[model samples]
Target: MPQKTNLNYWIDYWNRTNPASDLMDEESLVSFWDKRSEDFADKIATAGGRKRSRENIALLEASGFCAEGARVLDIGCGAGSLSLPLARAGAEVTSFDISPGMLAQVQRVADREGLSVTTIAGSWWTANIDRLGFREKFDLVISSMTPAIKDAETLERMITCSRASCFYIGSFPGGRDAILSDLLSRIGKIPSPRRPPMGFLFPFMYLYLKGYRPEVTFSRRRWNETLDTKKAAAHAIDIISHDQTVTPAMNRAIQRYYKETAVDGKCIFKNEMFLGMMVWKVRP
Candidate 1:
């Protein structure tokens, strides 16, 4: 029997936690992102949010991979957060996402600005990379802070498709989500007492083993979200259901919590976030 690699360990851990098949199927997943598109667009349009996009591009360029004329692939690009900015910076970008609604947001901007962005809608998990001509076809491939890149297969897909470089950014566990925290405790899902796993570590270590010394960096910020209370409540229930069987009582409790906290039908969730990023040039 072969020994398990770091990638195997990470995949096992991700499967245990995410349960992608059980939680959401293709249609429901698309609907999920479609519903969140409006809210995602609103937040990413904000000053702070826009600044974050600029910062990501700047960091990527700082690693010596210039966006100008680069063939860029942004996986799970929600509302074109990085895709739009990168396109504006002269990259010929392919903005790939699962939601037609979210891709429409990118298409709108591309039409208005005539930026070189091609929006494609499909699940990363279901994408046929070879048939799509994606393997080693990009100068840079990015999978940043997306649940889609949970397993080794997804992580390796980035590597197989990139000729020049790859950048990945993912969240650190144990952030402060005011409403989620309360609802979690109410439903008997208090956060683990043990220390949480470091974000992006497994991916970074995996890349290192494959002979790339990725530049790893950590960032912390506060995200202030303005959510549609009704939609947000339903979404929260969907999230809660993934971890535990959401009983009818638990569902109502989540809804009631959202209603009580919302002001004028909008819920503002303020939370601090810590993220880890790794960038590496593809070795010859």
Candidate 2:
């Protein structure tokens, strides 16, 4: 028997720890983003946001994936950050997201910019690809920092929807938001004695094992955020306390941390984020 690779172990651990994730329930996922739609769009418009977008777009352009008139499908495209740019570049862009609020924002931005983009509100995991005739229908498929690509089946399905190529952006191993980390530590939510494998490494290894030569690039950028105390506490709770209800104790801990950490009447947090951009061609 072959030894279990880190990717396999991490997948097994994630499935066990996050059981509901495999179901790919649209409501659960959609609701999470719905609450975050506005803030998410705002973040993308920030200096860090523009830098990340430009880097990813530059990578795509260099790869020849964003050729004029290319049919592009951006899965989990929130607020048209990338979709609108692709549309403006003359690609026929179909952007899909789980949040109607996000799709609405995408539409709003696209309309304001006079760029045409089709926005679909649905989950890629549960969407009927064939019924929608999206199977192998796109020249380029892009998923950036989206939770939709969680497993092998989902990743394969994403590839199936593309005719030419795919690009995925994921956090590098051990990546953590600085604010969330400090808050979680204050709240006594440290990892177990044994740290699990990094989530990003698995997909890259999985693709390699499947004979796909994915071109990998690493980008590091400093992301700084300033939020009011209440917003800061809420954001920290959301990121660190996933699936677990925030009890009064947790809330108090977050509030106290925010009060202690606030600088100049605002909660200021900064982190150098490491991201991996992976791209590969799909055989017809």
Candidate 3:
């Protein structure tokens, strides 16, 4: 017989994988992404970005959330990867993010494409959906790889805010580049083997126990990016030390790795990661 896990066990496991960080505090998280807004915008314009966006949109269509004239809310809609395409598809998209910089980029693209996407700046964890008229307002709600979907309460809120369906995508632990993994190990911080996808398992199981049948899809893709040595080094630093200052030794190691990997004026890093998608219809 299969073992049954309790709710507390799943919640605790999920929390362990997603540790709270002062650096990831609401204000700090906003500031961190505000600085990377432009770079992220450029990334989403690349081939890999288009690939992921295409798949996400396809899933939405398959899940019956891509109806025309549908009101969609994209939580943590960074750089409009999903929002822009949906807007162009004729959906009324309301894209929300904690960083104003990200929202600005989304609006900028929306204007250029002649697609109207309403952008809002706020953190889902602390935002009042009722005050913002988001309570049960959207035909489709999406929270893709966002820190906002942290617990059961948040998951319930996401479903409650949508009239029809809610779609979510999140990491599956082993989804980082091997180069970054090596660097982290060299620095004595070995990556955890516990997959981040396990984080999504809790919600899926919890929903099932609540008598809701959630449809799920699993996807794995290798992300490849080539950047100049400087950019590569900066990216490594950001990943290795989220909010902490990179020590001299760590910086030296990162630069050396980038220097060795650079070819034709670019440093390339390729890594495979898993993404889990869950879609639940809120109303029949």
**Model 3, residue 78: what's the lDDT?**
88
lDDT of 2 by residue, 1-284 (tens): 24356557656765675355334356656766787889878887888777777788899878766557899999889877789878888988899988899998888888888876998888776778898889999999988888777677678889999888999887775555776766666668633221212245657767776668887898777767788888888776664444556778768877888988888669877777678888899862
Query: Where does model 2 exceed 4 Å of error?
Result: 1-25, 189-199, 239-241
Candidates' TM-scores? Answer: 0.84, 0.86, 0.87
Residue 132, candidate 3: Cα error in Å is 0.9
The deviation in Å at residue 133 for candidate 3 is: 1.0
By summed lDDT, the worst window of 10 consecutive residues in model 2 runs over 190-199
**Model 1 lDDT tens row, 87-132:** 9989999999888999998889889999999988888877889988
RMSD (Å) per prediction: 4.0, 3.8, 3.4
Candidate 3 on 145-171: residue-level lDDT in tens? 777777776787788889888888877
Q: Ranking by TM-score, best first?
A: 3, 2, 1
lDDT of each: 0.78, 0.76, 0.78
Which scores higher on TM-score, 2 or 3? 3
Candidate 3 lDDT for residue 184: 64
